[model samples]
Target: MNTGVVTGGWSYVWAAYSLTAGALFLYGVSLFVRVRRIVQ
Candidate 1:
Protein backbone atom coordinates (compact mmCIF):
# COMPACT_ATOMS: atom_id res chain seq x y z
CA MET A 1 0.00 0.00 0.00
CA ASN A 2 2.25 2.71 -1.27
CA THR A 3 0.30 5.88 -1.36
CA GLY A 4 2.06 8.97 -2.76
CA VAL A 5 2.58 10.88 0.45
CA VAL A 6 5.55 12.94 1.55
CA THR A 7 6.65 12.59 5.16
CA GLY A 8 9.40 13.38 7.72
CA GLY A 9 10.62 16.62 6.17
CA TRP A 10 10.42 18.92 9.15
CA SER A 11 14.17 18.77 9.89
CA TYR A 12 15.06 20.00 6.41
CA VAL A 13 12.46 22.73 6.56
CA TRP A 14 13.69 23.99 9.91
CA ALA A 15 17.33 23.88 8.82
CA ALA A 16 16.62 25.97 5.74
CA TYR A 17 14.63 28.49 7.73
CA SER A 18 17.28 28.71 10.43
CA LEU A 19 20.06 29.26 7.91
CA THR A 20 18.13 31.97 6.12
CA ALA A 21 17.33 33.76 9.34
CA GLY A 22 20.93 33.55 10.53
CA ALA A 23 22.21 35.04 7.29
CA LEU A 24 19.76 37.89 7.46
CA PHE A 25 20.67 38.60 11.08
CA LEU A 26 24.38 38.69 10.31
CA TYR A 27 23.80 40.98 7.37
CA GLY A 28 21.77 43.36 9.48
CA VAL A 29 24.46 43.49 12.14
CA SER A 30 27.13 44.17 9.53
CA LEU A 31 25.09 46.99 8.04
CA PHE A 32 24.55 48.52 11.45
CA VAL A 33 28.26 48.50 12.21
CA ARG A 34 29.09 50.10 8.87
CA VAL A 35 26.57 52.87 9.39
CA ARG A 36 27.89 53.55 12.86
CA ARG A 37 31.45 53.77 11.55
CA ILE A 38 30.40 56.24 8.86
CA VAL A 39 28.56 58.39 11.39
CA GLN A 40 31.55 58.57 13.71
Candidate 2:
Protein backbone atom coordinates (compact mmCIF):
# COMPACT_ATOMS: atom_id res chain seq x y z
CA MET A 1 0.00 0.00 0.00
CA ASN A 2 1.20 3.51 -0.85
CA THR A 3 1.86 5.73 2.18
CA GLY A 4 0.33 8.78 0.51
CA VAL A 5 -2.86 6.92 -0.28
CA VAL A 6 -2.94 5.46 3.23
CA THR A 7 -3.07 8.94 4.81
CA GLY A 8 -5.84 10.03 2.37
CA GLY A 9 -4.53 13.62 2.45
CA TRP A 10 -6.60 14.66 5.48
CA SER A 11 -4.23 17.16 7.10
CA TYR A 12 -6.99 19.40 8.42
CA VAL A 13 -8.53 16.56 10.43
CA TRP A 14 -5.38 16.11 12.50
CA ALA A 15 -5.01 19.88 12.96
CA ALA A 16 -8.59 20.19 14.27
CA TYR A 17 -8.01 17.28 16.65
CA SER A 18 -4.84 18.90 18.00
CA LEU A 19 -6.56 22.26 18.40
CA THR A 20 -9.37 20.68 20.41
CA ALA A 21 -6.96 18.77 22.62
CA GLY A 22 -4.90 21.89 23.36
CA ALA A 23 -8.00 23.91 24.21
CA LEU A 24 -9.24 21.24 26.60
CA PHE A 25 -5.83 20.92 28.26
CA LEU A 26 -5.59 24.68 28.78
CA TYR A 27 -9.10 24.84 30.21
CA GLY A 28 -8.39 22.02 32.66
CA VAL A 29 -5.18 23.68 33.80
CA SER A 30 -6.94 27.01 34.30
CA LEU A 31 -9.66 25.35 36.37
CA PHE A 32 -7.08 23.61 38.53
CA VAL A 33 -5.22 26.85 39.16
CA ARG A 34 -8.39 28.69 40.06
CA VAL A 35 -9.46 25.97 42.52
CA ARG A 36 -6.06 25.96 44.16
CA ARG A 37 -6.11 29.74 44.59
CA ILE A 38 -9.57 29.60 46.15
CA VAL A 39 -8.48 26.92 48.62
CA GLN A 40 -5.53 29.00 49.70
Candidate 3:
Protein backbone atom coordinates (compact mmCIF):
# COMPACT_ATOMS: atom_id res chain seq x y z
CA MET A 1 0.00 0.00 0.00
CA ASN A 2 2.93 2.33 0.70
CA THR A 3 4.67 1.48 -2.56
CA GLY A 4 4.71 5.00 -4.00
CA VAL A 5 5.29 6.82 -0.71
CA VAL A 6 9.07 6.96 -1.05
CA THR A 7 8.94 8.04 -4.68
CA GLY A 8 6.36 10.70 -3.97
CA GLY A 9 8.38 12.14 -1.12
CA TRP A 10 11.46 12.31 -3.31
CA SER A 11 9.61 14.38 -5.91
CA TYR A 12 8.59 16.87 -3.23
CA VAL A 13 12.14 16.99 -1.86
CA TRP A 14 13.60 17.72 -5.26
CA ALA A 15 10.98 20.40 -5.91
CA ALA A 16 11.83 22.17 -2.65
CA TYR A 17 15.53 22.06 -3.44
CA SER A 18 14.99 23.38 -6.94
CA LEU A 19 12.88 26.28 -5.68
CA THR A 20 15.45 27.19 -3.04
CA ALA A 21 18.25 27.03 -5.58
CA GLY A 22 16.35 29.31 -7.98
CA ALA A 23 15.78 31.91 -5.30
CA LEU A 24 19.42 31.82 -4.28
CA PHE A 25 20.51 32.15 -7.91
CA LEU A 26 18.37 35.25 -8.36
CA TYR A 27 19.65 36.79 -5.13
CA GLY A 28 23.24 36.21 -6.20
CA VAL A 29 22.63 37.90 -9.54
CA SER A 30 21.04 40.90 -7.85
CA LEU A 31 24.00 41.24 -5.49
CA PHE A 32 26.44 41.02 -8.40
CA VAL A 33 24.65 43.85 -10.23
CA ARG A 34 24.61 46.01 -7.12
CA VAL A 35 28.34 45.53 -6.56
CA ARG A 36 29.09 46.40 -10.18
CA ARG A 37 27.20 49.65 -9.84
CA ILE A 38 29.23 50.57 -6.74
CA VAL A 39 32.56 49.69 -8.36
CA GLN A 40 31.86 51.63 -11.54
TM-score, candidate number 1: 0.81
Pairwise TM-score winner, candidates 1 and 3 = 1
All candidates: CA RMSD (Å): 3.3, 4.2, 3.8
Q: What are the lDDT scores of the predictions, listed in order?
A: 0.97, 0.89, 0.91
* Candidate of highest TM-score: 1
TM-score-wise, the better of 1 and 2 is 1
Q: Model 3, poorest ten-residue lDDT window? A: 1-10
The residue ranges of model 1 lying beyond 4 angstroms of the native Cα positions read: 1-3
TM-score per candidate: 0.81, 0.66, 0.69
Among these predictions, the greatest lDDT belongs to 1
Model 3: residues with Cα > 4 Å off, grouped in runs: 1-7
Pairs that clash in candidate 2: none
Name the better of 1 and 3 by lDDT.
Answer: 1
Please provide, for model 3 over 1-40, each residue's C-alpha lDDT reduced to its tens digit, 9 standing for 90 to 100.
Answer: 7565454478888899999999999999999999999999
Q: After superposition, how far is residue 35 of candidate 3 from its true place, in Å?
A: 0.6
Tens digits of lDDT, candidate 1, 1-40: 7698888999999999999999999999999999999999
Clashes of each: 0, 0, 0
Give the alpha carbon lDDT tens digit for every residue of 5-36 in model 2.
45454788889998999999999999999999
